[model samples]
Target: MGSLRVYATTGLLIASLSTLVHAAKLEDTAPYPKAEAGFSRQVIYLPQQSEEENFKVELIAGKTLEVDCNRQRLGGVLDEKNLEGWGYPFYRLEKVIGPMSTMMACPDGKKTRKFVPVVGDGFLLRYNSKLPLVIYAPQDIEVRYRIWSASDKVGTAIQE
Candidate 1:
């Protein structure tokens, strides 16, 4: 009985330590540079199962931005700025209004995709893109996001 108790205690310690390490890594990767500039305003549609909901926002270069909506999905391009042909740090999504979905389409028609529900308002996405990362938020709530680049602040976008 003593041996079993010892083993159980050891296992619990290992599990707790692993959880702590994982949490630390996540904290370290959180977005930074609270502000950014060089943004242009644009209108994006959050598609709903019933009807398409539209929201206007300002997109800044080199920063992360997010849209908010519920039962809706946000979809848009990265504009003229191209991340192709150069190695860049993996971009991460810091938060969301709802669930998050991502897709990358090659000029040759190949595509990569992922879908994850936003558990709360604190979900983040991380990706390394050969092309600009195109994202979709599939929920019916306001979306928010942060970029994970040390050299640039998180992108700003105003909702309309």
Candidate 2:
């Protein structure tokens, strides 16, 4: 029984000290602030990737709407904002205004709830795994992202 207790105490000490070591290596999180009123902050933790510079992050912010059978799209301006003093990059999604759609009649007034994505500039971002991507958007807005990667082989442009 004495030998068992010694081994147990040693295991506990190793576990506790391991956690402290990992915690010390974690990136600082002091700059990211809480959400502002009427808006919520979203976080995206990217995984470490090889050659991350060849990748891009595309943020899609939009809302689901009941729509008829027509071509539809949502519009919002996604702007990049820098944190005060630290200059850490973050994104803010403006209010989604119009779901401009083609005015075509649906068969038998059929309607369906569809995720209409925002269409605008400033959505593509450079991929960096060191810090999490923070975004502030309206409470009603939904944010999503997809990763894009460049081809390994670079093609030279044709000379004019």
Candidate 3:
């Protein structure tokens, strides 16, 4: 009878300890805090080539959001002054190339080549609350991004 009581107590103690450990883990790892008005830098590189990559962002009211995509390579130094003068970073690793332009087919079967402001490299957007942004890149390209909050501060250079 005494042995039976000891076994029951030991089982209860083990269960209680397990529950406490689980609760502690939950409290330790919490979700990321919602972004407010601030600047953040993130590097995103895909393992394989993909058609498109999407990123979600939360923008505060009356604040503008600007995203700059910089290709990361071993050699070559990024020109801070040139980037500031150009208003944004240019994806010119091999050579100095401009933004991407594509031709779109109209409903009337007419093809028109128009200049799209945002390239595969980077873009500037304005919105309130949460929004999804998409970017297209080549396979296995190492891309670094700089996100800024507030519209008027778009061209302002930030040292990071």
Candidate 4:
């Protein structure tokens, strides 16, 4: 009984240490604050069957992004630009929850939409700050984008 207790205690200590190490790694990787006035761009993907067109968005640091949908008409504003477009009238970005400091892309040439899960969804992209920006089609439709970056960190947007 004493040996079993010792083994259990050792196992518990190992588990505790492992958990601490994992937590430390996560903390180290936590998103850092963006450089002053820094901004990140995100592409909006519309569902294929929907009439709404895909669009590009630029978000400044310390700002929140949101999109939402209702039925057949789509409407939303970004970066102080209010846009009215046709499509699923209610489709709009709700919000972007982030501690993210990087951007990523899908290997399959799809863009990342705000509605898609950034961590564990099929649309989750591999983070890369250097690649051309692209937004995936919100639905099953094929759309192509060729973003031209004016600077290392900014790109010309394509809106349809």
Candidate 5:
């Protein structure tokens, strides 16, 4: 019984020390502030401009970036649908994301309208910002972006 108690105490001490070490590591490497609390989401609304433009976005580890483009709006207005005179608004990421691209030629006319992600009612992109992302979008399309981060310590966005 004495030998058994000695072994048990040794094992407990090892376990406690390992736990403390791990906690220290977690504290040191944690990127988000108050990450022990949980994750958070940030949203951005981009309006149409006269020219095709690139928007730079910052990303962090363990967070995800999601983008959705609305093409059915009438005159760049959200929720103002016009079926008769529908314009197909679209965008392209500088980096190949998922199964989307500007390189893939989308045919013109009503048939081309079917190819838009907005027509399918799904997001144009859902990515983890491995690096800063550059998005290219048409002038008439409005974009809504949602970025999820695991830490609040990040405070303000270092990347726009």
Candidate 6:
């Protein structure tokens, strides 16, 4: 009976400790720099994922472009920059420029405003739920991201 009570108390203590750890804010961990003029700062907080699975974070930054059903690619890039003193990472989209699109004539006569994602060298960041991802972009553009992970199962490669 005494052992059962001890286990219950221990479980509650651990749960409370876990809650406290997660409740801490990113600013509390370290100071991230402020966004410069003409740029807006964005933050992403990823949930704690299973440790066994490999995970990555990708940034999707761009602007909406008006189109007539032609395939479009936004012209711009996201440059990864680090905080001056801390060396913490952040992304910057310098300018939002063109929506270079396929010249295919639109069969339909209607136009639509669509979100054109930016393409660059890339934005595949390491997944760390403990730190918040910070991004800065021109105030005219939008910033978004997606979390990617790999399954644990490994496939045998065919011999050459």
On lDDT, the leading prediction is 2
lDDT of 5 at 125: 38
- Whose TM-score is greatest here? 2
Extract clashing residue pairs from model 5: 33-153
Candidate 6, residues 1-160, lDDT tens digits: the string is: 6965675466446534544555546577567766888888777766666671487877788778777878877767677787778877777778766777788887777898888887765567787777667788888778766655565589999999
**Is 1 or 6 the stronger prediction by lDDT?**
6
Could you tell me the TM-score of candidate 6? Answer: 0.76
Q: What 10-residue stretch in candidate 1 is worst by lDDT?
A: 46-55
Tens-digit per-residue lDDT, 8-61, candidate 5: 466446534544444434224223223122222222222222222222212211
Off by over 4 Å in 2: 1-28
- Candidate 3 residue 24 C-alpha distance from true site, Å: 25
What does the lDDT come to for candidate 3? 0.28
Q: Deviation in angstroms for 42 in model 2?
A: 0.6
Residue-wise lDDT of candidate 2 within 37-132, one digit each (tens)? 999887766656689997787888888989889988988888898889987898888677788999888768988899888898889999887767
TM-score of each: 0.17, 0.77, 0.19, 0.17, 0.19, 0.76
The digit string of per-residue lDDT tens for model 3 on 16-76 reads 4543444423223233222233322221221121122322222111111221232212222
Candidate 3 matches the true fold with a TM-score of 0.19
- Which of the two, 3 or 4, has more lDDT? 4
Worst 10 residues of 6 by lDDT: 11-20
RMSD versus native structure for model 2: 13.0
Native-to-model Cα distance after best TM-score fit, residue 85 in candidate 6, in Å: 3.2
List the global CA lDDT of all models. Answer: 0.31, 0.77, 0.28, 0.29, 0.29, 0.71
Model 2 TM-score on a 0 to 1 scale: 0.77
Measured with C-alpha atoms, the lDDT of residue 131 in candidate 4 is 22
